[model samples]
Target chain A: MIAGIPISKNSYQALVLSVLGIALVLIMLLSLSLGAYAIPFSSVLAILGEQFGLSLEGVDRSAANVLLQIRLPRIIITLLIGGGLGIAGAALQGLFRNPLVEPGLIGVSSGSALFAVVFIVLVPGLVSGSLIQNLGMPLFAFLGGLTHVWAVYQLARTQGRTDTATLILAGVAINALAGALIGLTLFFADDSALRSFTFWSLGDLGASSWGKFPVAIALIGIPSIMLMLEYRNLNALSLGEREAFHMGISVQRVKIKTLILSALIVGVGVSLAGMIGFVGLVVPHLIRIGFGANHRLVLPASFLLGAILLNVADLMARTVVSPAELPIGVLTALIGAPFFIYLIFKLNKINS
Target chain B: MLQAEDIHFCIRQRPIVKKASISVNPGEILAVLGPNGAGKSTLFKILAGEISCTRGQVDYNGQNLKALKTHQLASVRAVMPQHSTVSFPFTAREVVELGLPKDSKRNSERNIREVMELTKVVHLEDRLYQQLSGGEKQRVQLARVLIQIWEKKPFPRYLLLDEPTSSLDISQQHIVLDILKKLKSQNIGVLIVLHDLNLAAHYADRIAIVKDGLIAGFGKVEEVYSETLLSEVFDHPIRLVRDQETQQILVSSNSKFHSDLKISKQAQA
Candidate 1:
C-alpha cells in the first residue's frame, strides 16, 4: 500500500494568508497615523489600546478623539470597501468562469452610481438635510443595482441555459445606458450638487461614520464569508456548468446566489465609497496566479490583499496632495490600468 | 443493479432518446455503440441522472433515482462528459481532488495520489491541467471521476464514461479498459459509450447498438454485431470473420471477401 505524499499547497496558502492579514492590520494602523494633524505612532497605539481597555495614561484627548472618531472610521471603511470589492470580484470571476469578469462588468457599480446620482440631483432636499435624513441614496442605489443585474440575468437566459457572451453583452449595454442617464442628470445639477456628485462618483471615504459601519458589515462581510464557504462549488463551476452539475452542484442556483452576493457587496461598497474600480478586477487575478485557483485560499487572500491595497491607495490619495485629497478612484485607475494591461499581455502570451 | 426503464428524452421539441431501456448488473461492463446523432450521450446522461427522462424512470437498487438529491446520486455514480475545458489553471491534483466526497474515511490527499497513479497521471499531478495535452487532460479527468466513486467499503459504484479514451492512444485505451475490468471484478458497474466498435466488442459484457435515437439491437456481442444489423444501422455492409484458433469475431468490410463468401455459398447450395 502506498502512503500519501505530503502536500504543501494548502499549508503554503495558509501561511500567505496569515502574512497578508498581519500586513493589512499594520497598514490600517499606519493609514490612521498619517494626516494633516499627524498623530504620533505612539499616540495612535495608545488610543487604540484605550479603546480596547488598555488604560494608557497621558494620551492627548483631542488627538485621541481625532484618531478614534474621524480617522478610525474612515480607515475601517476603506478596509471594508476594499475587502468587499476584492471578494466580490473574485466571486464574480468564479461564477462567470471568466477572469475578465468583475463586479462593475456586470453593471452593478454603474447601476448603483446612476441611482445615486439621481438621488443627489432630483432629490437634493432629502440628501442636503442631514446625515440621518439622507438614507435614500444608499437605499436607492442598492435597489437599482439589484434590479439591473436581475434584468440582465433574465435577458441572458434562453431555453434553460445562460449564454455567457449574451450576459456580458447585455451588461455592457445596460452599463452604457446607465452612463448616459448619469451624464444627463449631471448636466442639469447645480454647482454644489455637481461637486458632491463628482466626488462621490470618483469614490471617497469622507462619509465614513460609525453609524453606517454596521450596515456595511452586515451587507458585505456576511455575504463575502458565505461566498467563501461555497468554494468547492466554485471550483467545480470553473470546469463548466454541466460538469459542476455532474459533481452534485446545483449550478443554476449557485450562479444566482453568487451573482446576488457579489451585487450586494458591490452595491453596498459603491453606495458607501462611490464607484471604486480596479480592486475587484485586479486583486483576484493576482491572488489566483500567486496561490493557485482554489477558492478556499483565493477568496480570503483576495479579501485581505484587496483591503490592504485599497487602504494603501486611500493613504496615497489623502497624503499625495495633503489637505486637498485626490479621489481614491483616480489613484486606483492610475495604478491599476497599467497592471491590467500587463496582465492581458501575459495572458495572451500564455494562451499562444 | 442499475436500470433505465423505457427512458425517453427530447431537446427543443426534437426527440433525442426514444424510449431506450437498458440495464447493467453489478459486475458487468455495458458498452453503448452508436453513430453520430444516435443518442449515446443522452442515454448516459439519463442513466447518470444528470438529466431527467421525459418518460419512464431510472431505478438503482429498488430506489427511484429521481427521488435522490444530486449529491446523493453523485456519491454512488461518477460521470465524465466529453470536452472538459477549464478557463483557469487548476492544478492536476486539485482537479482530481474535486471528485472525492468530503466525508471519506481515508485521507483525501492519499486517495487522490492513488487514483492518479492508477490512471498513470501521477507525473502530471503538479502541472496545470490547462497546460497539459488533450490525452493527459483526459487521463486526469478519468482519475478525478474514479476518485469520486472510490469508497473504502464495498458499495455498488457506477461509472458512466462518454468517449473517455478517444484522445488516448491504443496502449492507454487498453490500460483504461483494464481499469474498468478490475472495477468490474470488484462488483462495480461500468457503462461506457464508444465510437470504436472493436474496443467495445473486446471489453463489453454486452453491447447496445443505437440508431436514430432508438436501440437497433442490444445483447451479447455475438448477437448484436451481426452483418445484417450493422449494415442496416450504419447504412454500410460489414463482414464478420472469426479467428480459426481463438474463435473471436473480427468485423471488416472487404468486397472480395464478400464475393468469395457468395461463391462458396453457391457451391455449398
Candidate 2:
C-alpha cells in the first residue's frame, strides 16, 4: 500500500527513499523542538543558524543549551542506533533466506547484554567515569556478541553448509543460557548499579552525549557499510545456497561475513542503546512489504524508516509523560505491534 | 569443455557417486539418465562445482576447478537447479536479473527480454516469483540461468541443469529442450540430468546412463539406448520404438515390475 502509485519500480523506490530521508531530517528537527523546555521550532533553527553567523532576535540563551547540549546528541545517537538495527535485520534476513529472522534471533543482543551486566556487576570500579562508560563496557559487550555468534555458527555448520534451522536452535540455546547468566550476575550488583542498569536496559537515548557519539558512529557505521556491500551476494543467496554457489558465490564465505558484520552492528547497537526491540524486526518487514524484496531497495529503505520510526517514538517517549520518560523498548513494541498487525491484514486483503 | 574424472562423492563413508567420469564439450547436449537413487543429481552437482568429490578432480577447459574462484567460474558456467526458492517477494524479472554476471559486457535489458521470450516467460516477468506455478517457476528459473550465458564469449561456456522440465507439460517440455538445443549454436555446452527417457532420447545429442554411482552406458543416443543396456541399467524391461518416417528413437517402460506391489511380492515369495 505504501507504493500503491502506478509507476516503474526504480522510480517508485527512489520516491520512497527520498521521502524517508526527508522525513528523518524533519523528525529530527521536530524532536529537538518538542521536549520539557519546549524550544520553539524557529528558535531551534535560529540557534542552528547562529553557528554560521546568521543570528536572529528572541532566541533565548538558556534554550540553546537545552537544544545543543542536550537534544542534538540524543537525536543523532537515536538515528545511528535505529538505522544500524534496521539494516542489520535486513541483511541477516537476506543471508538466512528467511523473512522471520532478526538480529536477536541470532543471539547478538542477549549475548552482548549478558557481558554488559557482568562488566557492571563484577568490576564496579570501571563504572565511575568516561573510561568505562565510553569504551570498556561497550567493548566487552561487542566481544561477547562476537563469541556467541562464532559459537552459534559452529553449532549450525555440518560438513561445509550452515543449516539455518540449526543456527536458530543454537541461538535459542545461547540466548537462554546468556539470559540465566545475566540474572545470576545481577544478584551481586549494588543498589546504584542495579538502578542505573535498569534504566539503561530499557533502551535510553537520553544517555547519548558528544563524547559517546564518535565511538557509536564508528562501531555501527563500519559494519553497516560492510553489510550493504554484500547486497549482490545476499540477493543470489535467497534463491537457495546451491543456487547461489552455481552463480559463482562462495556461499560459506558470504554466510560467515554476513553473520559477523550483522552481529557487529547489532552488538554495538545493543551495548550503546540497551534493548531496543521491534525496530530491527518491524522496520525491515515494513520495507519489504512496501517495496519489493530487492535488497538494493530494502536495505536503504529500512535504514531510513528505522531512523524515522525511532526518532518519532523517542520524541513521544519524552513528551507523552513529560518529566517521567517511558522506556523506548516498551513503547516501540506497544506502538509498532499494532501497526505491524494492520499491515499484515492489508497484505492478506490484497492476497485474498 | 567441462570434465570430471573418477568422481567419488561420499557421505559418512557411503559413496553417493563413485568413479563416475564424464566430459561435455562445447556445442553439444549431454543428458544424464538414470532411475531414482542412481546418483545422477550427485554427479551433476560434482560437475557444476557445487560440492567437491571426495576422490576426483573437475576441470573447466583444462583449468583446475579447485583453483578457480567464484567470479571466474561464474562467467564460464550457469546452473538451473532442481528446486530453487526465493525467500522474499522478488518479481520474476528481478530474479532473472540476479543472474547477470557482474562483468557482462552485453546489454542486460536485451539479454533478459530475449531469454524470457525464448523460455516463453516474459508475461510473468513482473509477477512475484514465489506466486508462480511449478511450471512457470521452472521456466523463470531457466530464463535466469540462460541469461547468464546468453552473450557470445571468445571462450567456451557451459550450462548445467537438474531435471529442468520435470514440472512442465508436454508442449512446455519441448519448448524448454528447444531452448537448450539452440544453446548449441552459441558455443555453450549443456549437461542435464533427465528422468524422462523419451525426452532424453529426443533432445539429447549424447547420453550417459548411470546406475549404482557408475556409468553403465555412455555414447551417442543411438549407441546407448540399446534394449539390454537400458533394461539392465533401469532394472526393468523397456521397449524402444523408432519412428519409421523420422528415424528417431522413442522409449516405453510400463512392465511387470511396476504392477501391483502385492502381486510382485507374492510371485517373489
Candidate 2 stretches with Cα past 4 Å from truth are A1-11, A125-129, A157-165, A336-352, B256-269
lDDT of 2 by residue, A137-187 (tens): 778888788788788878987866668789889989998999899888888
Name the weakest run of 10 consecutive residues (lDDT summed) in model 2 chain B. Answer: B256-265
Interface RMSD of 1: 1.0
Q: Model 1: clashing residue pairs?
A: none
The global C-alpha lDDT for each of the candidates, from Candidate 1 onward, is 0.83, 0.85
- TM-score of each candidate? 0.93, 0.93
User: Candidate 2 local accuracy as lDDT?
Assistant: 0.85
Write the residue-wise lDDT of candidate 1 on A156-181 in tens digits. 78865667789889899999999999
Q: Chain A of candidate 1 scores what in TM-score?
A: 0.92
